[model samples]
Target: MKLRDLGGVVLAVLLLAGCSTSPVTEGQAKAISSDRVYAPDLVGRADSESAKATFLRDEGYFGSGCSHVIYVNNRKAFAIRQGEGVSLRLQPGEYSFRLETGAGMCPNIATSQDITLKPGSAVTYRILLPSDGNLRLTRIQ
Candidate 1:
């Protein structure tokens, strides 16, 4: 192959390597789940005044190989893998939910929404990562 052709091939390889979308391994996922530290005030106490919130990821073909970090009320809640979901019991109040791309992955792909939770109520939110690489939060319930 010509020198110029070889250069082109090398450039393509570099670009593809930089565009990695590898999914989180099982061990990494477990570590992420175990490393989460919730606020002490938010830990126990399930009662009539507590509200339930569920977050689900889209798991669509486009970005299903990547994991995202979820932040609740500006606190690091947990990491949500593709097609996975998590539920939390929170005190009835207003909360802000945000999603971000995992480390070494896409940049500038964060989205958030504010929701008010009432006692004895349950709410569900879905995270969508479209082709544009921007995160979208939608309320499905």
Candidate 2:
């Protein structure tokens, strides 16, 4: 109602806005440091019935109930060594990713995503090469 009162209110608002945000440092953001990565030991195999390519839950977080199915096709294919497996470390957020065996079940792909990973935790997903081959799923603590 008064000029002096209005000026005080504006000053308070400005101060609050100024204190709202501060630039984040690397340490504070927790950017993926090399030390935080723990590659999971995944073993690939073929499906028994189909005799096609399939990945099984072998080591690490295998049997931890984090099992999932993923499809990898020529379009969205991610190359993985025949014997050597791959690992990914994700922070707290929602990630959409695709995995492929690099080689067919009609579409020759099983896709899963919209995965909500918790902070400081991980999940394991596998793709079986053969219908009955050994596929390994592992999670890291």
Candidate 3:
């Protein structure tokens, strides 16, 4: 094979590797629940003593159909499917949210913000899978 052709093959392999999707294991799938109900009308109130935070993974029809395991403050919170979401009532404080597929290739993705929750505030975070195949957290509210 020509040297140029060999380089092209190498580039293709690398690109495919980066675009690979993490497979959801049976245990991980079992750990995820699809029963969470999202109430749009219910949110944090100004007079309330706690805040409401919701994590949504809205991949629509473009997702790989794999369940993504979510971790809040290092504890297994719940799993969400495409177009599904989960919510938590939290005290006013700083928190860390992480998402992982429990796959071997794809590493855990986390929120980049300070994630400070204030009393009577409601925040919604959407998990986005961009064209580059990396997971990102974006605040929609």
Which candidate number would show the highest lDDT if scored against the true structure?
Answer: 1
* Candidate 2 global lDDT: 0.35
Q: Candidate 1, residues 7-48: lDDT per residue as tens digits?
A: 999998876555434333222322224445344344345788
List runs of model 3 lying over 4 Å from the truth.
1-47, 104-113
lDDT of 2 by residue, 95-118 (tens): 554543323212343444445555
> Model 1 segments beyond 4 Å from truth?
1-45
Leading candidate by TM-score = 1
Candidate 3, poorest ten consecutive residues by summed lDDT: 23-32
In order, what lDDT does every prediction score? 0.68, 0.35, 0.60
- Estimated TM-score for each candidate: 0.66, 0.33, 0.59
> In model 1, which range of ten residues has the least summed lDDT?
23-32
lDDT of 2 at 128: 33
Candidate 1 vs candidate 3, TM-score winner: 1
Model 3 per-residue lDDT tens digits across residues 1-141: 999999999998886655443433222322124343222222323347788877766533334554576666776666667555556777788888776663444455544445888887888777766546667676778
Quote the lDDT for 141 in model 2.
22
